[model samples]
Target: MNVKLKLPFVGEFGGTWAPQRAEAEAAWELYVELATRITYVELRPGEGLVREALTSVYSLFGTTRDILRRYGPAVSPADRAGELTFGTLALTVLNLSLRPMLARWHPRLLAWEDRRPDDVSKMDHENAWDQIGELRAKLEEARLGLVQLADVLAKVAGAAPLVVDPRLLSNPEKERGGG
Candidate 1:
């Protein structure tokens, strides 16, 4: 079935995402998370690192993994035939970009916690850590990968490139449609 989508500033566009458009729309939601919520921070060694920051990265891994598993198979044969399609790009990001970073860091972070001294608080241990820079670099790489994936997905879906306004992030109410 042909699905018509009305996008802001882009006019009307149509695409058939096989069984239903909802699957494609569901996959596109990851673009929102990658564009808005996932931010890059300098996680330098010997600098204080908040638990929440690392937690967010872990969440990123989970979110991306879940999306890949859910939507990777939904890619249409037409999209898969192309050399540079959303499905291929998403798989590349998940397997080549994110998986390695997660594979290395997840265990390392756990080990660091395991080695934490009895008297030292988790916060204090994190503050005294000296391996944060590597993690930061990996995160930055993943961020770039995710952004690239989002851009490709946008093109595939005929959506405008995401240009997040700082105001919208701060005041969600301002973005709500007024009655």
Candidate 2:
């Protein structure tokens, strides 16, 4: 399938270059921050940590989606390639880190009711577990979608040309070999 990748910006002299670069840099910083928090959550895995990690992940995902939306439909092939690559990497890491935690939590939460039948009825426990399981599955699916979008973003980021002075492009080629 022929996919037309959208460039972040297209104008004489790349009119939106500065703002776009700044936004991308900011997003990168946010991603790093969230990743760090997630690492901590992985190590700790307390109630507070789980809540924080989930909140941070959702926040980061929303921010990334917003940034991608701004690029519109003008992305070039190279740019799309770069964006997709980075995005997929990020999502892959997220899935690897989150899956085990979710799996562990699901069973623990389910078992809690069995141990305390009087405190929490089997039906209530089952209902809650089912709901949580459904939510987790949905979240997993969303994570996969984000990975796909990130893959596209990575492609776009990769394909973009590095910033160079106009004079450089116009200058004659120079040989590096010694005569």
Candidate 3:
């Protein structure tokens, strides 16, 4: 994945770019933490408060998006061989999967939070949410996408991910009936 490039004052620099590696490592670390947190958050279901769930997920999504922004540019040149770049893939995951879910849910959840009864505990309010089941399903989808993205980031960085999702062990394209 190494690519040669010309620097402003340094002439031709070769091998893996230092900035790219740094960004990749940083992005990888963030992805791992986010993926793990999302999984844990999803596992217990209605045990946590609605605000806690919404804010945590909202924060993670924003952070992940920011890391990908930096990481994508750094490694972009290394992946310009007409192959699908990690930048493109990361963008796809964010736009196609996470964005829509978060767009619809964040505002909806906030509205729900606004209407919470004065007497209701946070947990009780969350548990009573009519869309808890739907939210849980969206969380599962988002978690899977994050895990797959984390695996790809690990591959790019040549590091061992703490959590390797089983679904990603298989060829995802083939699983989806693509070559």
Candidate 4:
């Protein structure tokens, strides 16, 4: 998409434009990451959520909830059960009832979305370092949660997962005649 040639000022530089921003591409990459992890966790539903993953997201959302409580009235109450913070959504998505299905988290939805006319571009990045830090922590928590869900599944299982066959472990859909 870039038509401009990089006239290097004094060092190496290149003009580039892509269909998606790096963050957007990373967001799509998360789909691949989620798919892989989902397949692994499918074999072990009896295993519970990892404490760190649970606590990490809980803390992140909990803190964010506290912060967003001030702006709660700005976001639509219908989209979310409670506050609209990312942590709250994450926890809701992973509630015990939803444990059988693999859940993924989006970092962008971690904060309050204020549609109030006066709130546009109102985000004070310089004053929001703490919130940014929490977002980073949330990202790490998500990475660990996705990567470690299966490991934690394997480790925390009180008994062997009721896998039909050892071969089916890698492709459980076969056992269900879906593979």
Candidate 5:
């Protein structure tokens, strides 16, 4: 079926995942930071999606959104391909990195009076955001890179097909939607 999706994302420009390896890594970290730092486990209740988490994620989304807005249109696609790579990495981080941490933390917190995971507090000390000029620049550079990577993913997903299975929609039809 003709479909546009944010899923199975593969948006791009200037042919492929070029000129932005660092940025691409930054984009990946955005999802990682969101998954690992801001939230995880996907269920808790009122405090599960609490305000502090929302504020942190809001900052991240705003930063990334601004980056994408500035750089997205400049991408030129040499090939059209599904951006499943980004989606897959996101899923991997969610399951392998974030979920496992929560799994291990959940029971321990329960034993220790059933407190929620408060691990993120340590980041403030570790990052020491003010003193790390190099670190900050790296992050900014990564943000810029993510803009391009996200662009490729957005475009690719926009025209990509929606298929339940291989038999339902042939490979030829699926590839046709890409550049």
Candidate 6:
């Protein structure tokens, strides 16, 4: 029997945020360690760890969002001038750092869900796997968005102006694009 394995999204873009990558890797390791312990519980065993991991992930996300919000706008005037503001770098690092944690947690969460008892008799295992696949796809998209934002931030880091239209920043569409 051939068993299909699901893989997490891994990016090749490096150096633009190396420190962030290290931090993110460490965070992901911790998350995995904690998650493994939690998942072993025969009956909701890792509830506390799960909550803690969720809280950490949410906090990281919030920090990233705040940094992006603060630095997304504002153009740099010249090549010598620094366009990549501290806020923008912070956002990039945080986003990059969270990649591993997000990747691991997503799979664990899906596995847990898979083990869960199906209330509706009509619900099928294949359907559950499909749902997990969908969730994984969404996660990948989110990660890609962060990477793209980081790429833009890297360009700004190289003396690009931080000038963004203030009105655009306020707009939901621009906000989604990291302005």
lDDT of 6 at 108: 66
Candidate 3 backbone overlaps, count: 0
Task: Pick out the ten consecutive residues of candidate 3 with the lowest summed lDDT.
Answer: 5-14
lDDT per residue for candidate 6 within 124-146, as digits (tens), equals 43234444454444444443444
Candidate 1 lDDT, tens digit per residue, 29-84? 76666666534433354444544555665576577667656665564345445443
- Tell me the spans in candidate 4 whose CA falls farther than 4 Å from its real position: 1-93, 96-129, 150-179
- Candidate rank order under TM-score: 3, 1, 2, 6, 5, 4
- On lDDT, the leading prediction is 3
lDDT score of residue 161 within candidate 2: 28
1 against 2, candidate with superior lDDT = 1
Compared with the true structure, all predictions reach lDDT values of 0.56, 0.40, 0.60, 0.33, 0.36, 0.40
Minimum summed lDDT over a 10-residue window in model 2 is located at 7-16
Sorted on lDDT, highest at the top, how do the candidates line up? 3, 1, 6, 2, 5, 4
Report the lDDT tens digits of candidate 3 across residue range 1-179.
55443322233333432335655676566666665674433545755554565566567667766776665565456545444454544455556666677788888877877888999986787768899778877676665556555655666667776766556678978879997
lDDT of 4 by residue, 1-179 (tens): 22121111112112332222322232233223343442223222223323323344444334334433543433223443443322232233345313322133223323333322455433443123344344344434344444333222222222233323345456667768996
Winning model by TM-score:
3
Question: How do the residues 84-154 of candidate 2 rate in per-residue lDDT, one tens digit apiece?
Answer: 33333333434454444455554555465455457775445544554445444444443444333333333
The CA lDDT at 129 in model 4 is 35
